[model samples]
Target: MATKEPSFEEQLAQLQQIVNQLEQGNTPLEEALEQFQTGIKLAKSLQNKLTSAEKTLGHLIDDAGNERVYENNTDDPSNNGGGNRGFGSGDSVKG
Candidate 1:
């Protein structure tokens, strides 16, 4: 389910849960650092999600008084021992 699309609210809630645990849980230095790194990742993810939403909403306004929408079709390769990331179209996999 890692690749499944998550809503903005869901992502924010999950990130808060992670932060709260890190603040309350007692752990060794190494584990704490690892959690900190994870927190950074979650922060980036939340930022990206919010940015995308903002962009989508602003797509209705343009310099020429026209409205347009942008679609992200980032190519993602399938997980068949290939060299692609496999997150979008133009990719195939073999079982």
Candidate 2:
């Protein structure tokens, strides 16, 4: 039998626990180093998951039921070409 992989939430919680342990300043140097490395790996895995989700959400279905890449309407008067100012630019999602 194979071991089941932890879900994203479980991995995030484990990373938080590791951070708390490191912050308490009670663990020995070697243990602390090990936890720190594990935390880095978990963080990277979480980031990759988020990026993949964002890409998936970049697709949309129109009224005609045609699948198309989502496009931010920067030309709208209210948008003022700053629709994606804070988040990543719309061009980041390529079809």
Candidate 3:
């Protein structure tokens, strides 16, 4: 049987643990270097996963199986020219 892959949260926790260990300043030079390298790889992987998730969330899928980019309607004139729409405002997409 193949080994199971670690989830994103698990990887993140591992990276945090590595950081804590390095911060303690007790590990030997060679071991510390190895841990640092591993931490870097984990950071990059986490970043890539976050970026991919963001891209996925930035789009909307219609019932017609068409994909559309999610856009903020901050330019709507009904707001009386006030563009102070807070976060998550203008989430509705007009057809």
Q: Which one wins on TM-score?
A: 3
Q: Where in model 3 is the C-alpha error above 4 Å?
A: 72-95
Q: In what order do the candidates fall by lDDT, top score first?
A: 3, 2, 1
Write down the TM-score for model 2: 0.69
Q: Write the per-residue lDDT of candidate 1 for residues 20-89, one digit (tens) a residue.
A: 8778877777887877787788788888876676566645657898877544333332342233444664
Q: What is candidate 3's TM-score against the reference? A: 0.71
Tens digits of per-residue lDDT, candidate 3, 1-95, equal 99997899999999999999999999999999999999999999998898677667767999999999775434364653335566557577669
Window of ten residues with lowest summed lDDT in model 3? 73-82
Q: Which candidate, 1 or 3, would have the higher lDDT against the true structure? A: 3
Comparing 2 with 3 on lDDT, the higher-scoring candidate is: 3
lDDT of 1: 0.67
How much is 35 displaced in model 2, in angstroms? 0.3
Candidate with best lDDT: 3
lDDT of 3 at 68: 91
